[model samples]
Target: MSESTPFRAAAAGRPVAISIRNVSQRFGDAGSPNEVVAVDDMSLDVRRGEFVCLLGPSGCGKSTLLNIVGGLFPATDGVVMVGDKPVKGPLPRDISFVFQESTLFPWYTIRENFDVAFKFQNVAKSEWASRTKQALEAVNMGAFIDHYPNQLSVGMRQRVNLARGIALGTDIILMDEPFAALDEQTRMVLGEDLSELLAKTGKTIVFVTHSLAEAVFLSDRIFVMTARPGRIKSIIEVDEPHPRSPDFMLTPKFSELRNQAYALLRDEVRQAIALAREAEAAHA
Candidate 1:
């Protein structure tokens, strides 16, 4: 038999950038009727400069977990630590988030959006122009610097959104299905660009995604979550190096990893769908 590869070695002695210890998130107080446990006793560690993906069916609370890690919302139980410090609120200086929706100001030009984001991060005014130019160039959006968000295509807008996040110069970047709205072709292109960007920057990244291929292609490890009251079901390692090529997507190994993830997730997705239908029926 071939020797099995060690999973921990993928991280190769990198320090943990984000740590979630038995974290649980419930929307309402204990014994409350409207309570919803969005996450349940989930523990995860993301190593510095690693790309990790949170993959799951809908309602599995992947975004909720990312939000908690980003301190957009606090967990009801347990704690989150970023680079050895407990996260109690938004850590703008250490973390950046790219949501599924474009949060860019529609009236603002692409460069203006980046300017505003840096302002929010309290970056020095003198550094804004150079930093914005550099980040946009990194994402290949330097040409559209003056275009308003509305004028850009969905793919272009997302590129700008990504640029804005990178311009913040945070050590950790948390993405909540940032490519969900893009078409398959656009997603693939953006994913490739993102993979290259990660390789170049060595920034720690945690991305949330529903696409199995996307997860397999972009992540060093995939964290699969169970349905509502979400918990980590399994962690699958992608043994490939980053700056992954389109040819990798066509390889048998890529499909095998993607299929493994799908197999683990198929039943959970059905259950989530059934639960949603039941809830809808009750409401009706």
Candidate 2:
């Protein structure tokens, strides 16, 4: 339909920006001995400016889903659409990704890394300096504009990685455990910055994370998934506005939402563990 229509008329008047319909991602051939199913028959809709988190146990293909939606690869079945167009391959200008590890080139200065991404996105040279500067300022890393990635601490490097993603000026960002390597305190601070960035830019974000508190703190809605061949088990809404404070975590409501997410994922975590064990035993 038009931009005026919400997916299934469910997402208020916000208009669906990403539509994932019955998408399944697999590797190897079905009925083959080594076949693997990463995601199975899952569907989701992300509205414009929405922050949605995919939370699940190990091997649940949270990252795989993010990859499919970002068009790093197409799904094995079903389709993922950005606006009205089906995602066939990388949409560099429309989507950007920040992964678990810092992706900055070690040899390049921070400014050079932004230039590289700008080239890939076909961003104009005139916009490069302004975009890079604005993104670094947002993440409080403007002082390190000339520094190389190797010179920064892990947390600092990740901040620049996130800034590069922002500088690309995509409407959507897919982050797969981008803060997974950091200490709890650092992750919290970065999460706060991300929330503020979301409020400021109105960009759509699909974040995959394993931390319950992080998911509860950062997400507008958390989509919890089952074990391998991942499928959505629950969708929990934070029901709060953007630029949320750390004080929000101190409230009973935050605790309640976190507990609910844990309850939903606990079984899935166990199931994932059991499946891994069975697979190992069969091989043995």
Candidate 3:
């Protein structure tokens, strides 16, 4: 493992891009019967340009944590600092999101969608075309610029979605299973594309996913969380560099990391299932 990669050591020396300190999220009033704790006290630092994955059971608040970091909403406790700015609300210029579902407006052409994002980010009109072209070309979607979202297949639209996120030119991207709906083969291909993007752009990424292989393949470090009232169970380092080849997955290190992640989550998954069953019974 030590000879396989130097990313882990290199990551430690990078400046922190995101600082999450004692963060917790709770839904409903404190002490109420309906109160739900989505995240418990959690803290971590994501280094500049590092790709980190939040992986755990279904109800483990991975998405909640991502949203908190992105400032989609406030966390019930603690603080999140992106660079020197404390995240009180959405920092559109510094952050972007790519979710599982395609967020493209069906009526807009691919080019129009990028235009809208750039406009919202207040990027100069002069840079919009160049940014759009570069981003789309990076994802192999430049030819589809004039096509509407509905005109493209799921995978194509996702590529466009990814391209749009990149064209926003943010320093950080928070992704919530952006490739979850795609077929396995398409997902793998997109994963590789994402790796290349990471290497080329050097953007910090915080991704939430349940797939062990995806976590192992794409992350510099994987944060495996416990079930609801989610907390970090373990942080597993992949120790690999970006623009990774699929051939890396054929190696023993990949298998070792994947198996380790699974072992951590297996018990948490069962616990989440049991909690769901209990909730159903109580409602019944």
- The candidate that wins on TM-score is 3
The local distance difference test score of each candidate is 0.87, 0.90, 0.90
Model 3 off-target regions past 4 Å? Answer: 1-7
User: Sorted on lDDT, highest at the top, how do the candidates line up?
Assistant: 3, 2, 1
- Model 1, 1-284: lDDT tens digits are 01122475356468789988989988877777567788989888888888999998998888889998999878889899999899999988999999888899988888788888887888889989998899889878898889888988888888788888889999899999999999999899889988898888888999999999899999988888999889988888887877889999999999999999999999999989997898788778
The count of backbone overlaps in candidate 1 is: 0
Q: Given candidate 2, what's the lDDT at residue 173?
A: 97
For model 3, what is the error of residue 253's alpha carbon versus the real structure, in angstroms, after optimal superposition? 0.7
lDDT of 2 by residue, 1-284 (tens): 12222323123458788999998988999999889999989888889998999999999989899999989888899989999988999999899999989988889999999999999899999999999999999889999999999899999999999999999999999999999999999999999999998888898999999999999998887888999989988788787888889999999999999999999999999999999999899899
Total clashing pairs for each candidate: 0, 0, 0
In candidate 1, stretches whose alpha carbon ends up further than 4 angstroms from where it belongs are: 1-9
Candidate 2 ranges beyond 4 A from true positions: 1-11
What's the TM-score of each model vs. the native? 0.95, 0.95, 0.96
Query: What would the TM-score be for candidate 2 when compared with the true structure?
Result: 0.95
What's the residue-level lDDT of 135 in candidate 1? 87
